[model samples]
Target chain A: MEPNSLVKLNEARRERQAAILLSEIGKGRDRVIREGDTVAGPLGEAVAKAFRSGKSGMFELDGQEFFLNVQVPAPRIVVIGAVHISQALAPMAKIAGYDIEIIDPRTAFATPERFEGVALRADWPEEAMGDGYLDAYSALVAVTHDPKIDDYPLIQALKSNCFYVGALGSRKTHAKRVERLKEAGISDERIARISAPIGLDIGAASPQEIAVAVLADIIQAFRKRELSAAEQAKGAA
Target chain B: MSEQKLTEHLAGNGPAKDELQVAQDWMREGRNLAIATVVETWGSAPRPVGSHLVVDEEGNFEGSVSGGCVEGAVISEAAEVIESGEPRMLEFGVADETAWRVGLSCGGKIRVYVERLG
Candidate 1:
């Protein structure tokens, strides 16, 4: 084991980046492979699969054994509302293994008493997550139902490539929002990724039931997320 | 976020200490340490392959490669690996009854690779 490999891997994880510590069994060789770093051949394919699944395991390449200690940053949720649905979604998302944070500029709604144990921010999404909270591993849901409050984060979530970007609104409301996003230079393909009228097609009537539908939708998006290799490494050329 | 923020246990999930961070901290402190990882497993191994257990010179350890079933032996071996700076592969299973008094209660076999950090 290389002494620096452990430190590097830890650093990558702390920065919310995915990494893999590929260690040769018994041979004492090791290296850290960050997301997007390319390796060639059959071993590369195995590494790619491991990165997608975030599963660490033993691998045999040309009869030589190696252990891939793959690490994918835990996925999370960023909510752009402190509404009734978010109040329910916050706790339920955490229970579902997705850390959640709610950002709402409306002080009256963002009160700690309302959010209880959630990671809440009373500031606007532009203020709370302006430094790039939206990422490929995060699910962004704008449930404020107000364009003034929800539009910025929704646009940012699309540009930042959040795995799940959902907006709360009816078909009529989404049609207007779509025009706005298109005018803002968002490509049609990326705009199509938003799950407006958010949540699964379950007959959820109350805020709590809607939270369940949204949580299930987020899980499905995360589990079935496409492992596109293009986003693995940024600026490594 | 820093490791501290990431590990704040903010969510309701179970605690998962970043064992590699602990290992790095020990290394930075100039403490002789060894890392033991479950490189391979068969049957009902408690911990999955690539699970790590980092041990310091004073016999202190963090993480687990097994369900507290074979850590004592792995840690003792790690102390020697730290001293000799040599990697070793140790196997434990029901079939290796002659080598270990302690075997996986779940009837699994695992191969652990212990190596010095340096």
Candidate 2:
């Protein structure tokens, strides 16, 4: 390939990747990297695989080798409370490669010493989520157990296409919470998006175990979304 | 460079700033380049599936597929790939005695595909 053409391709690929990363839609786009002298392979299959898996790797088609580089935005976990569970969940999410932020209006709970190395926002949920920070690539967990602190953010998260929306409470508390949400004009479908009595039913009793369940549930939700997107892409193809 | 500097470079502010960005920058600067990617792995590979190693015509490389074990060989093959405009699939593992000589003593197998990147 000529140097000029190569440069143009590289520039275009970079631009596309930058745009996707900035958008944080959690959908990965694929770029086909073929042998310099070979014709490109079936792009639809490549794109579908890349988007579905969100993994970059090489594949072969008709004896021609192609590398499908899939670019996905970093996944984010936005915890809506700086409680004990948030302290456990934030670092655990970080370890799982999620960009983490703790949002709570209570200054005492959102202190740096308590949640070290994690981003903390002492603003209300509406203000914090106003700038499109919570998108499809984000997972929001409400662990404050205070309706005043968790309700607005839960509503906001339900409205957005965030991959996961979870809140801590018992079945009775969640039932009451649902009624409150219904009174506040939230649709049943939207209210249903929340994983109330949050986290997997691993018989978790302590804050740490609950955090584990929560992160596992969030991962399950994220993977399910990816699988569905991939299936959709495949069906479209 | 020191280990500290290497760590800092890899940990630069965010997720290892897409290695493709480095390849693109080098390509725009009129440098011939080849990209090596981990396509498949068996057992306990050091890096995950999509790890990259970008090699320039002059043998300099950024990123890694096997940390340091198989990069030297990949870089050497990448120089040939850049010249020939052909791709190559490289395999390394403890299963092969020859691979053991080449330093893939980690008891895992990795398959890397190298292609010239425009």
Candidate 3:
């Protein structure tokens, strides 16, 4: 092979090596949870508990308790609106470890200049939310507050295991939206997943406050599931 | 042991270790290891539940279960448990002065379980 090809090969090898190294560390981290069943009985149980609730579990060894949760990868935050809240929220959500994606049909709002380094999708919600868009590790926040755009994604988001689904609107607005969703055939339970009025009641008045409320609600939803599961397990027992 | 540093590591793209080599090292070591996990927390707990720290026979450690409060105590305890091939439940809280002396600042309490892993 030529020298250039050799250099290229060497670089490729390093890249591949790095990639493998990263994956291996991840595997090592998970091995106690995966192959852990045969080796450690309680580690497997801890992982099972973590998977069920996405929270950590405690294991007792040598008369001492150790706490661990399944290493849950951060959820993907796909915002279907590039409004002011999105501007404020995308950065905060990214800081919170959400893989943030902002979608808007308007070029002015959706441009790289506006979002800079953030994932910007200049497409309709229906289009942007394609390809198994929502997953267990996804939180869909509809700050667009425009029904024409927000409704479709809300419907689509309800069809997945999104951990948090929130939309910015008042109770009256949500009620109207719910009526339309009902007309569109959305069930009461699925519609219930949406955090309408969108946020913890931090007496939020500004766009930033609203974003904080919305993020707070999302975090609460994430943490609440763990509590609910524990309650369920206790009830079962 | 810094909460911010650990979150930064986990929240970023992915892990920074080699898979085959780590797997081979694990395979070579081939003994059950005990993993202590923090499952839940509230109110200024040193570390939230779900914090993790793993230990083997050699006293080598990776990860943290508390901000810095009880890891030393946990590690020493975990090594023996890993060797004995049994599990134990550990709790740390500021319910009393002794508990505070263990350094659970903020009066927070956490429950942890440590079990051996193969």
lDDT of each residue in A54-159, candidate 3, tens digit only: 5544456556444443444456788888888888888888887668889888777788887879999999987777755775567889887789889888888877
**Against the unseen true structure, what C-alpha lDDT does each candidate score?**
0.83, 0.71, 0.63
Clash pairs of candidate 1? Answer: A36-A232, A36-A233
Worst 10 residues of 1 chain A by lDDT: A228-237
List where candidate 3 sits over 4 angstroms from the true fold. A1-58, A61-69, A226-237, B1-118
Q: Write the per-residue lDDT of candidate 2 for residues A1-237, one digit (tens) a residue.
A: 234433444564533321111110111122333211122346445555565456766656566455555555677888988899988888899888888999999998889999888899988887777745666677889988889988888877776767789989989999999998998888887789899789998999999999999999998987766433443243223
RMSD of each: 5.5, 7.2, 11.8
Scoring each candidate complex against the real one, what DockQ results? 0.62, 0.26, 0.14
Model 1 per-residue lDDT tens digits across residues A13-132: 888888899988778899999877788898888888898788898889878888899988889999988999998898888877899999999999999999888899999777888656
lDDT of 3 at A114: 74
Give me the runs in candidate 2 sitting further than 4 Å from their true place: A1-67, A95-97, A171-176, A179-185, A226-237, B1-17, B93-105
The local lDDT score (0 to 100) that residue A203 gets in candidate 3 is: 96
* Candidate 1 Cα misplacement greater than 4 A, ranges: A203-205, A231-237, B1-16, B40-49, B93-109
Q: What is residue A230's positional error in candidate 3, in angstroms? A: 12
Ranking by TM-score: 1, 2, 3
lDDT of 1: 0.83
lDDT of 3 by residue, B16-116 (tens): 54322332344356744556666556566766664567666676667667645677778888897777756666777634554355444566777666655
